[model samples]
Target chain A: MKLKSTAALIGSIIGASLLAATPAHAQNVKIGLLSGITGPIAAMAPPMIAASQLAVAHVNEQGGIGKGGKLEVVVGDSACNPQNATDAATKAVNIDRAVGIVGPACSGAVLAAANSVAVPAGALLITASGTSPQITSINDKDLVFRTVPSDDYQGRALARTLKGRDITKVAVAFLNNDYGKGLAEAFKAEFESLGGTIAGYSGHEGSKASYRSDLAELAKGGADTLVIFDYGDGTGLTILRQALENNFFKTFIGADGMKSDAVIRELGADNLGTFFTSSPVGEASSSLESFNKAFTAAGQSPDAIFTTTSYDAAFLMALAIEKAGGDNAKLAESLRAVSSAPGEPIMAGEWAKAKKLIAEGKDIDYKGAAGDHEFDKNGDVPGTYAFFKVSGGTYESLGEMK
Target chain B: MELIGLANYAIFMGILIGIYALLALGLNIQWGLTGLFNAGIAGFFAVGAYASAIITSPHVAGRVGGFELPIVVGWMGAIVFAGLIAWPIGKVCLRFRSDYLAIATIGVAEIIRLVIKSEDWLTGSSRGITGIPRPFGELDYVASQLAYLGLVIAAVAVVYFLLERQLKSPWGRMMRAIRDNEAAAAAMGKQIEARRLQAFIFGAAVMGLAGALFVHFNRSITPEAIDPMIATFLIWIMLILGGSGNNRGAILGAIVIWLLWSVSEMITDRLPTDVALQAKYIRIFVVGLALQLVLRFRPEGILPEEQARQTAR
Candidate 1:
């Protein structure tokens, strides 16, 4: 009797799922908005999703996809882990029939989803926040791309900028995660190649009560400048506070992850006179201004982490879909055509103009709110960056880093 | 959706169910048959995944070998290595009672996770090892998925039949005796500690094989993939809700739970955008609710274990 009821229950669930799988409006083109909606980065996902939706809104408002087809997004919760990531990607590709997928957020999720589901199914993937250097090495058949720069580029850029400022020797303390480790390795390589000395280098696990012992060891190397590659609100704050109280390092450096207001709010800008951080920045352009105005009007903070990139990834997908004429096989090529150079510039929210250009068989280049998005051979962007210092309870950009 | 698309989705689900069914079977050997409460399924799963990944993946800098061996060798290595690691853990931890054993195993799993996260030379640290080749991966999408599904079904069948045979044997009776009453089993001269250790190691090996299949199917392995919520607790839920003591129940649990997990999103996607985004969290809640309802109403699970009756010969 129990087995019979259980069978009936399973049968109902399958039946309901089949009913749910029926196709929606035929004139709507679907794209997958895969994000870490429920896991480690849950706090950041809502704004990012809002930003992507904002892009879809711009597309539909401006004129939608080709031949009056409405651009629709199917959101999937990747949960910031590979198991859910792959499952979400599979459903997005096979069930929703999304021609392109915009994200899985975290680096590991991106790798798993792209390799297992998107790449195999010939769906184009553009991650907004997956920054690990390993992504550049995926055998993705040119179908995988990211709006955000890899940690490698930022690390190397920071190293070069620091050398330009005449700081040759530094002690590095990085959090032991993919983000911190990738940046540290890249920074170390670039700094050493430029004849700079890494007086001390160490990776520490996060959330420890005190890092004084680790600070003491790093101070023994005699480098006055301490470079941290971790989140400002987390271990990086603890490390900085300990180093300041102990007088372990005279000057400090941080990467993009460290450019947080939490550092200023916690450590106080008065004591951080010698602290500086390198962060990615959209080049001073009308593209960023337009996105900011539109996103703020949508009631979301334009400065939210990855919001711009998230917006850009979705907008680029829309353009690619338009260019590809809904053909899955040509999405990769269409993405490159719409986002790269040798075409008329299409700023964010100019979907109508871009759609007309594509329809007219004219080339178009997407100047994204995050960056120009002129993808290299590996579908990676050599991101623009700027060095910043804390001032008046906020970050003040010094100037662009070459 | 087109029939081909539905077929592809079903194939993908089947592959995942097969992998998870193996995990449930492994848990059954330890917790069901041997009456050991092992909460560190993620540790053994990670061990198998990384071992197979390091063995089969091509060589990369700053990490252990991509010996580039045959895929089968990698799968075998995963099983052997997972069992080997389980041996030491079971020896030290099996002495603890059920609850204590659970605590100890969770700690062990956390330790294993940290080691994998920190050890760059062996496991590539947090960036993880990629480029592990998938069998039949070169074929077109549908063909590749179909082939992999076939492979997974074969693996589950072999493991299922072997476990069934083992369950009906004298060893199975001894295990049941020890589980029901250790003192009584010992009075009958059963080796409780050694047999428990054997069960623990055997279960871990099966878990390792599942991990290998998972890593190969994904063509990559990352620390994120071994998250306790998905890799460990989810499998536990499947086993408990399916029927811990019944092998067929374990497979059914995998099928039902995974389908609910994957299908719930499709249903929710039909909602308005804001509601749909919020509705995603409901799927997680639904999973927990199903477990709660099952535990409340059907304590022995959907298919209760069959009693072995003594009849006239």
Candidate 2:
């Protein structure tokens, strides 16, 4: 009679603990998302997070991963800082037991988090927007991967695109961080290798106000062409605005930082004609055009921004998880098998279609909402860069580097 | 209670308690013994941190012999530099009331961060100073981390001993007299400015030593690594809670607060999914609430120091 009572008590305890739960979060496969929701980079990050949320909703609607399992993404705000990012990473890794991590938009935050913790613990950590060369170079771990190509490759592509143009010598301005330095060094190396001259390479802190004082120095450059390897808008946006106010330089060439609508909106179309190079996003590819229409139909805009990249990042991770049979440890191994390769068919912004291919055991390639989601051994795609020119008050692609 | 390796657990407790003990003692010298309130402990910590970082960063140009320096020299240089920075800042702001001093010191701390972030020549900016070789290169990474933690504790013991000895000396007597009544000490012709300056500088130097120790133990340092919240308020909380102006109190405060914080965090982390989201914020709230209650109930602290007590006994 005592043993019967004890068994009943144990059964009740298990039922109360598991069955009394009111939420679906317990059974869900959790993914961690860290973002700069309210920091200096929030303008670039907020929509990316929103887009990632949309992707998660869409994935869950299709019965989530592993047929019956749920998919839920937990988020942490980094405020674009190292300590804050580490704290977020720790919470996600230690507490959430996230199978994968999706963001931390800037290189500064990513640098503090990428290795040491998640990769060693068998979690797949991927970055959507951060493009510093060091992010990939500092690792031999397969768990650490990125969707965007490093600025090193982008810098090289920008130099090559300008090689046949009228520009002979170029002055460069860079933000003072890994993204800026690596890009500046690569651009200089690529340009000089092809007999081009660098008038000057100057750097400034990213989040600062007023660049006029500094821009005044670089404005009277001997080189007519100016390559800006710096973030255009932030605390430091004041600098570029001040330079434009003073009419410092006319022929402006920019890195991915300049590709944002926020930058164009700040500088205006009258300041267009000056070109900036960035990823081939929202370029109206047949595949991408269809994606934009569907994304808009689903109440999301498939724009060429961090949002699109983050969305694709989420989708790819889910696909990788499915391909690896829902094992987080094996998801990273399947990534190389799925990355964009020449001659392999590209799966662009169509996961529903890729789902069929994933089942058929075909060499499935993924083209994301951002662009062709290819990755080098270093976990970067090094894809074609679109040379955008501002014409008639909007940025239009003049050509692209493939 | 039945967890294996009781020996390892004791060692862990011993090392963490010791390292934090040094941190508290260093702050004790500044705020406890000397009456100079600095909310910028993190700045000096960062300074000593970057100094060793600048000397040792493999990515940095013109490194000493292209390798990290001997850990002893690195730690010593860091401590001395920490003190040197503090001495001047104290001289400039020490004349003001506690709140004003805090404001100025906080501003100084912000400036330290801005400089570290902008000046890539010194601190490596956003990429941060990485690949800092371990103190004992022969040990593996985890072992090295734990071993370095042990070294910091041992270092704190030496500091604690010296501090205990100094507290019994004439210098310490003068410090207390000034702390009790600055004007009275001045009237007694105790060279008030010189005495305060000496203590401030010495305390800052010790704070810097803690910073260097932290970097080597972690094998990394970032401008953001030494946060004001941790370096500034954590010290204040520990010192106040443990009973300020007492060595034993300071050590006890560090261990107690850190233990509660870690354990509470672990518990909150394992909570059910929906509540897990709120658990972190709840944990912070609990810590804050407990501290408030402690202050209200035991304003004199759990182990209050006897005022105007005999010198050594």
Candidate 3:
């Protein structure tokens, strides 16, 4: 009894001290910048984080949220692991008091954060890169939104891209995750529906040392092309190398995750001749051009998958916060107002003008750098596709997927 | 206002520590008492998680188990399934030395990971099973978090009590004897292999229970829920640092290590973006260094194993 009482007393003191430690800072509206900074896709984090920071910096320079109140971003590393992502989301929302989150990056991490943290905490989360169709049905009450189109759109685009090349038969090897599974399933369905036969399909676990067996089996299906859905930094390289060693595959079709300089460097430009990749493209707009310029001017690459989308995610969340007058309860509703149509058009880097329009109590359509977003009730964006093929040691845009 | 948030964070941390404590206790039973190094705690944990998830989640197209049974039933299924899986593995590996068991257990874990990843119909095909009904999950945010904390605390207390009782029993003494001196204990008519197998399966069942607790708390389970090596090593360190034979030590080590890891992360998170980017590696280095320091100085652990008064010889 004595020990228990002592524990209770200590706990109360700790709680009281914790409560006292936080003095209110109403001038800064905290936003969470979350991404997988230390896992399979860690390579993708530096630029994405920079993009978010650039958005915040740009917002601050544009007279901030409202009446000189700044937007402060708290960075959280999701690590691309579900549990870690959940924990990171919780900390960013609860401890750091972030009113909104700009990312959780990967579909799996975003899913974990959305269901486990964002929804429960009532914090608005705008994922910059999550493209899994599974995210389309996460039950987040519109709190979870993404700048990228789901794989449902990417799959159709991939099907069309492959068919245009007269490649009708394909074997598929996908990393086991929401992004991989959703893209693979969507691609298979669209490809089959388009009269192309799926020669084989294998969903392999990621981070494995090798995928020789699965690749060999996929090879035996007699498909001329191997369509792989996986992040370039993880098992995708190993799988391709193993298949090459076994002479299992040469021709390749890949999704957005494979549109990386790392994949080209690792697989060699010589071997990429027969390779083609399709990813969601931002509609060509002056906003996109400016964002690309600003991003590169900050000494970061703007060409990586999702870099522009991440910048737009941060920019949109800040706009929402500003429009809501820093009230988190109204932030979600304000997000829809800012990103959807039926408003005065506002381009990226026009935060000062957007602030003026919001002050006039007029709805402003944020034509973001990534695209013109008109969020559905489920917070999904309309998708456009960019087809690219390896050329001159890098991926050169072939054409739009239409 | 910030105090409430901190309290909620504490509760979340407490809940995770409690679940990890269950795993640590399981490891204590296996390695601390029986001299068996079951390196596949993550595998057994996954079995429990996937089993419970399969049992309790709402039915989806192309997947098994729309039963949507009560959470208790799911937990029971988790324990039973994890125990049964461990039973076969233990039967095959308990006859060998600990190194062989380690290798076999890791293999089992890898295989289990593959099954969870590849078997889409069974485990929801990498999107994983979601919408798991969390008890008291419907309550308001603070209330819900508190209720879950209460549930986790209760589970840990029950596990701790039962295991403590089991530890002081005759079977516990016999198991310790076998662990300390296998030849002498074998000569004394204690069927060592069978007993080891029993402990192994029982420990794995506990780990499965931990998985159930975790899945229910998150209200979802994915193939990537647990980092196999990092989680397994953390639990191993907890058991080693807290003193293997002591139940209290196991729980203590869990809470301490988890707190340290998370607290360090929170501190590093406050750094500037550029500095914080490099802080994650520093956090890992600190954890690694702490473990080494603990091993070098207090190899027997914070609370060293209490030596039994009676000698088998």
Model 2 agreement with the true structure over B244-306: per-residue lDDT tens digits: 778878888888876664456457646664465445455446657767977999865556665
DockQ for each model: 0.48, 0.20, 0.52
Q: For candidate 1, what is the TM-score? A: 0.93
Fill in the DockQ of model 3: 0.52
Could you estimate the TM-score for every candidate? 0.93, 0.79, 0.93
iRMS values in order, in angstroms?
A: 3.8, 7.3, 2.9
Ranking by TM-score: 1, 3, 2
Task: Give the distance in Å from residue B288's predicted Cα in candidate 3 to where it truly belongs.
Answer: 1.7
- Model 3 lDDT tens row, A280-386: 66674688888988988999877777888888899999999998885779988999999888899888788899999999999899988888888887899978778
Cα distance off (Å), candidate 3, residue B163: 0.5
Docking class of 1: acceptable
Choose the strongest candidate by DockQ. 3
* Candidate 1 pairs with clashing backbones: none
Instruction: Record all residue pairs in model 2 with backbone atoms less than 3 Å apart, i.e. clashing.
Output: A208-A235, A208-A236, A210-A239, A211-A239, A347-A367
Clashing pairs in 3: none
Question: Looking at candidate 2, what TM-score does chain B attain?
Answer: 0.90
Q: Candidate 3 on B99-210: residue-level lDDT in tens?
A: 9888888888888887887787899867788888888988877788889889989988998999888888998899899998999999999898899999999999999999
Which ranges of candidate 1 are over 4 A from the true structure?
A1-26, A207-217, A241-248, B308-313
Task: List the candidate 3 regions with Cα displacement exceeding 4 Å.
Answer: A1-26, A205-216, A233-250, A265-271, B308-313
Question: Candidate 2, chain A: TM-score?
Answer: 0.85
